[model samples]
Target: MTDTSRRSLLGALGALTVSAAVPPAAATASPARATPSTPAASPSPATAATSGPRSSMTFTGTPYDTAAFARSSLGELTATVLPGTPVRTEIRHGGQRVAVLTKGARTVLLPGPERTFTENKQSFTDVFDRLVPDPALPPAKRLKPGWGTSPSGGTWSVYGGTSGDTDFGVHTKGAATMLLKDTEAGRYATLTDDGISDADVNCVAAFDKVPTGNACSFALLFGYRGGGAHYRARLSFTTKGEVDLRVEKVMNGETTLLAEAGPLATEVRAGDAWRIRVRRKGAKTQVTAWPAAGAEPTRPTAEIEDSEAGLRSGRVGVRGFASPGCTNLPVTLITGRFEVTAANWETPPSVTHRDWVRLLDAPFDGEWTPAVEAIVRGWAGSMAPDVFSYAMMFLPGAPGVRGADPRVAGADVLGEAGYGKPDSQGLRPVGADFHDYLERPWTFPDQTRRPEDGQRGNLDCSGYVRMVYGFHLGVGMMAVKDPAKKALPRKSGAMVDFAPGVRVAQRTGSGGSAPDLGQLQPGDLVLFDVNDVAGDPEDPDAYDVDHVGIYLGLDRAGKRRFLSSRKSADGPTMADVSGASTLDGPGIYADSLHTVHRV
Candidate 1:
């Protein structure tokens, strides 16, 4: 993509707050023509004051001053707007120009190109008011409680229990601590603070006597939105030194277990401190525990992603619950640290192979016809620019060869081949290595060779289509009753021959070729015979289907466009038939457009 196009896409990340007073023609009509213009005069000090905020000023003159207007507009929005840097407050795309400004978590866009500038009655305050941060609220800073201090002057709120004499106070000895103990059976006590939405609470806890026969537990509570709804990460200790870590959600007097870990074997002595940590953010929750003196475990004891029951923001705290038999048992919890912060939004350098596979399996949930939907899902799932690898095709060697190991081919021909890594917008450049890999012919090993001997990481045009459609729709391009008894095929011709749901829609070049381009929809398979060595066009047996692509509907210009992994500068790209070249030459449109298949 061009730099202008990329900038346009990036600007879309911020919410678009188009001025309501903008002229209908400017807002909805086609692109306006760019006319030559004279420089605009700078406004005087008195005139600038009456123009409301300088950021909301609109240049309204016949001969528009593009340069001066950009400077004045950018100056009001940001203090760091440099003249020549790429990070300049102003961005231009084709004939249109926009000024981008950011303050704290809010971003604002001001449209320009003085000649076509409309009266923007919208104020800067109005735009900022609509800006919503990702988490909606900022995270609280890490907190340390004062030792031997009461909950009255501190951040915590201590509540006395109604069931029995509950001791809810701080015990300051070696460290400042918050302790909660209940003597009554079937009663609970809590020490809470509403300072955080998403956070991690680390503390050490000990039971004076482990509960026997009845339940006794200490828990970290989050998403406490009152009305009996909250999420809990609990540690249940038994007299036998068994500890069970669990995550639960309590809503409307009902408790749902989200996740659980083992009744871990450990020595439980009186006052033996067990370090516990609970981290909750977004839809994910995790809990971990270990001996206070030992090193913390790398993995969490219990973790869950409960989008349905997960809470976004609420009061976070600690609580203790007791059953009938555990009346007199005292559970002590001492705080070490409470840290609440926003989740990282940056993308990692690379994702795992398993994660890459999950991207390929993303479901297609569009509101189109089933056939179209299948194809749309297939296409959407297969486009992963960050994870780059050469296309490889399955090669079944020899006919009627039972138990023959299938091999793959394509990567060897293109040296230094690997998956392409994309930028922030999931777009990767078509480098020299990718172009070299695509220029080779499809090849496969003979029946005697194993799959390991063939190219390791590669996929071709047909192979890509097959992998997506087969995995999602259960429709295979290369159908076989028993693969062990026969060799695998690699050519697009072979795929079309065995594709179960495919039917020929049109055939070009010879006998009768008339394709209704308007009838085409996204996901339709477009096949081509790149080599026209045979004379007969109508005869399917005469030509081999050397290339194939999936129709992706029309472009903004109403031209029919198809996506294909081609031997071009842009590895996998969307090409319009109106501007697409033929196999052997630079001619617009394909020379031997053999068949269009509805699959």
Candidate 2:
């Protein structure tokens, strides 16, 4: 999964709309800007994107037939990556040219416009036959005479046809349909097919009649190794419209239940389609089912871990069971369609990166201006992400703002680091008062009464912003020489009034004032009043504000997510470890949002 050519730079929160006191060890590198430019050769249209919210779609196995599954799933052919070393092919479905395949090399050359593929500067001219050979599928056969047309090019093996009255056929209703009927007791029907070990199987099925007394069962069977030895994930319908799910291991003629999900809340009718999926990877298998028309549940219904070597790999199929009392009803189960795919299927970046590009195109009232866009571009072109990630690095037993255990007398770790108590200029924490006793690289300026780290700096919220803008980007203010204007005071509250940056948004309230997101953009400084501190009449702008973070763009759920260094996570994180990086709704700092600045 490692790509050596990835050169995406870290975009810090836009530009320094304000200034802070430069760190003593700040780098003297010249500030860089993201000027407009174009690549030498335009990349082909992207085939897929990765920005979609998490999906429930699971695969049956990998190294399976891509062409057959692609046709079966009816999903657009975005891109395909053949896993290998020295030679791996990444084929983008559209466009004339495909990317090169070689050891430690990826290049695309103009191979003369004849729908050619390039590899190591060599032209694979019009060799579609060599490029995409029809893959060899596993051996299979249809046992019954009227089993109907299998859309998978006849790759299916029939089983459990001892009773002559059992029937099977394909109808025109779905992508691939199986029609089943049973006429006698203990009579069942099954359609199986061979595939790789790790796989994903999905289908929609329903019964023609409700169970009155005897239970009617349908199952998606996997790990089959010949006559009757396999794992089956079954759904049994009973007398009261209730459905129970079970995972069972069958050996010879004996059946053993592995896992069971008691009756579910969803009720099934005569023609209701219940979409079922079976995903088996290594020793773990998961089964999920829901109404085909409804949203898929986030969690699996039944799961099992079978490490038995005897049932590790096998074919997958569908099975139906019936009793003599249900003969007239024929115990009908209609499976409308089936789709199978490899376990490791994913899209390329250029496709998904377009999602953020599209988001930038969205119109926000006072946001999304040309100047703001340039600043955002500059931030992305900078080393912001890398520096931020460095600050987030884990350092076990690292000293932080909270000096040490007070139980141990004179346990003043910060005092040992040469930091002193705060002075009269601003609301600054003494060395010992600023820490949460967490393991993080927390460094602040010497004037802020913090440590001078020879290693990675230990940073608080405002200290982190200062490090990024002042130390890393080299646009920060110098040390204070006058009392008239403080050099970016070393506190979140002080930044609001003293930091020389554009105030993006501010609201004065008791608390619970969320910023108007439409007026905000990526790279903006997001400030918060975590404690709802009592306001100060003398210093209106700097009062109440106590925390700060950098704004990232919208997440998959379209929520405005930001990045911050904090005590709860013991480092920096955009994830919901303690609370999400969002401004409103159930997050920890959601109600504490106070003001915003562009720095």
Candidate 3:
């Protein structure tokens, strides 16, 4: 695999686009190449290098991106993408399309469709058969028809004349797992990758029936270059109920055992799942296996160093083997999932602020809205899917302020009149309009709101800043009470002057001076002195900063916008309910935009 060859392969793939049209019922002849249904301009070098040479497929969406790999004649390939999901190209041979391919943020060569195995099933119901329909053959005969049966009790169904008689297929249950359909002969399927030398491959699988002897096993394969050439990590159960893990290198059908971990104390029983991991880096290869329900072991179960450079680079795959010595009856192996990750493939991270904004449900130029939602979810330790609501809980009694519960509108304020403080008439101090939650209960002063009530989360301007940078993202924005620290200070006003990530900027006062906007990025923090409280020249450190918000790039009309929790909105918002969250126009908070920080 040379650079010139990889570039040529990508060029061939660049011409193909994923189509939404349903696959043809029968195997179609592999055209010389597929033409784009909707032609677009070629990607520039910059655009082509946006993602790394990494791809993923979850088989969640419709089968796409197969036009480029439809020429595979080794076996049948079929895919099914659930409706309304994004298109992800699937690799399904043997009657099930279980995975899709997704490019990483920095990709150089997108993996092409492969020619391996046959048939595919998906999480979707009603898997359409992609094998050529044989009206003359019965259903059972069609399922495993072949030129002849191999030594094993399996037949090659898709590739009828192939010498191998082992049956290789993935189960169509809850999650797709490649099933070894009771075969003494080893069978494997490979993904199509170009020049992938340093790679990691892993999967979770379990034995359907414990082997009577050592002849049955599940395997992880890498550096596969077709025709039985690759590296394999084999895990098998012994008669003593222990597990045997080993690594082997195969070249053109010749097998050489490299490393072996003789039977281990860990007992393996039928239906007990284990995660097997194998990595090939340069001339060194390592393998590890552990209970799928437990954490992966820190050390490899078996490791071997081979200076053979021919086993340097290729694709990744899976294999299954069973013999008569292991079981008199037929057995099946269930593989829950499979994954491959290529390391050391570097490319630039070029996702733009505008791109992120386009994904948010907010109106034009409102990408920061979802970012804020994501931050809030991080703070709550609950990142599961939910309705986009209640980013921040404002102090009770702020107009329209409420928690996730409609019944919990305001905080339970314990007023000084009700308590022992006779000098103060209200729950908060005099001239202290906004009470910072300070990472404490948002239901402070009264402290009645509990986590179950959903009213206990709250943050003021500075608290929100600290939550985003210091607490959630660990940006070292010192805690609110730690005014003595050298890092970004606790209060909003202090941050405007002494922020660690502070960038030089022109200030726009009440008189409305045009500020420099070129230096700002989307995640930067914008500070404001909305009340002109910074005008107290004598005590600059003690003066208050009115507002702070997360900068969102530019809106549809080209106005710079930000996202923040406000008393007017009673929670986080990017809307114009109180004042537009913009900074450049004639909006209310625009004139108060004084400084910016990019922590």
Candidate 4:
């Protein structure tokens, strides 16, 4: 609904009939005095005159009731009828002493300072009636009862008795006013209209006398269905000005109350009004209420969900009752308006997915990072010392470091193949399989066997790199398990060659031909082609990329440093390197450098 129309409806909801209450203190302040007939543009101070007697008048507390006098040509003024006077009442304002009265004739005089007077003849009731409308007859509407069915399995007529007295009935005074009397001491009388079913129903009722006593209730019914077996919701108000919301199920003439809320505090009186609205969207139902002349409340008075699910839409109307010991008084409920409309429901939009490169490009705002280098640095700072061990394959496992299970030996740790344990030193193993370096003649040798095929707690250089980058950093470059297969593809040089973000550069003896040292970022792998098993020099034809280390960027002295799992003595330690000759004494780098790969 448009906000303006909704506000108007809400205003109508809270509008109450004005009462005969004392005016607030602010209203007793003196009214504005009139300006003199002088040529000066500014207004003059009010002239002091004899103080008038206190008024015995009472005012009706409706707002802006004197609007007619405010808009009249005579301008705003108040008339006070004087007691013990000779047929005269004072007319005030305009800096004049004016009065209108009758002595065998009617007269109006605007007396001047020299006993001179100006006279006019006008009716008094025409002017004063605007402030207080005739109170003998109040404003109200007359309604003819509509026809509908009752829960007693019989035909029903509203405001009229059906064939059997067991059917619902209503009695009206004159042609249009219905007096809902609960003649049956303890029975509830309900009359529903034959309105079409709708998803949303709003019913506003004006009560002439708010009901009281135990079991006394006046309610609005919505979502009603079936003849005698149906389900519906109710918003009931008690004479104590408490409101209750309830949902019920009726089957074979029996009623079951499902859900209820309140006895909520509200302002209600014998001659006041209230409104109730019910709305259903899918399985959720909401009910709301407000004083007849107030704005719509921000939240629902009661909300409920029905999963039993039967009647989704139904008729709407009014029902009331009083208990046995309660006074059987006549209750007249007048409906100002009843509206039914389709529910308004809007769906939210879905989120779009982003790629890995886009994720890496996202801002590095301290809390989040996408690159493996950042992940490694964060892990290194948080992990306890000696957590990483050289020549050991640490598969995902339970908390503490323990030996691998032999039952799943040689099985890929991709799925149900199982994981390995950390070494007894509480260090995370860095190898997939163990290689005898004594016989291999190489510091960092390529892994020749899968993690499952090697001795427990052993891994080669490549396996260490794979575990740290793939398992620790969760990079997708690692071998992913095929959903239909029992094992994932083996990790080999071929997989690394085609891994995501992996860029390889052919090497030259000069070392300058490799990735520029100045441009290298952390996590870059420095690959080396070391001497073969025979202890001979490197051969281009059989140049196996045997050794690698993760670049950890420049140290305090601006020299480059990298971390790697070396021999047992060094374990996983950081090494400093400057140029080819200045490279510190380490297992494999002591031989020679070849290609470098950024991963």
The C-alpha local distance difference test score for the whole of candidate 4 amounts to 0.35
Model 4 TM-score (2 dp): 0.28
Give the Å shift of residue 100 in candidate 4.
87
Q: lDDT scores for all predictions?
A: 0.38, 0.43, 0.43, 0.35
* lDDT of the structure predicted as candidate 2: 0.43
Winner on TM-score (1 vs 3): 3
**Ten consecutive residues with minimal summed lDDT in candidate 1?**
120-129
**Which lDDT tens digits does candidate 1 get at residues 502-555?**
243556445345443433434556676656555356864344566676654433
* Candidate 2 lDDT over residue span 430-520, tens digit each: 2222222212333333233323332122345665555444433333332321133223455677677666444656775565456665546
For model 4, residues 1-599, the per-residue Cα lDDT tens digits are: 23332233222211211111122232221122121121111111110110111111112333324332232224434455544313334445465333332221111222211110000100000000010111222433211223222111112223322212323322321111235455452122222222222345455555566566633454555444544445455556565666666766666667778778776546666656566666655456566766657766767766676633445444444554454444545655555444432221111111111101111222122221134223322222111111111111121110112112232223222110011222322122333432221112112222243334333333355545554554323333324322322111223233324444434344554433443344343445665655433222554222245556555444433445455544321122342111121123343453454544443
Off by over 4 Å in 2: 1-154, 162-166, 175-195, 323-328, 343-599
lDDT per residue for candidate 3 within 37-138, as digits (tens), equals 211222212222222221111121332344432333235445343232122234355553322322110000112232110001000111111231233446
RMSD for each model, in Å, please?
28.2, 25.7, 28.6, 42.4
Better of 1 and 4 by TM-score: 1
Worst 10 residues of 3 by lDDT: 117-126
Question: Relative to the unseen true structure, what is the C-alpha lDDT of residue 200 in candidate 3, on a scale of 0 to 100?
Answer: 55
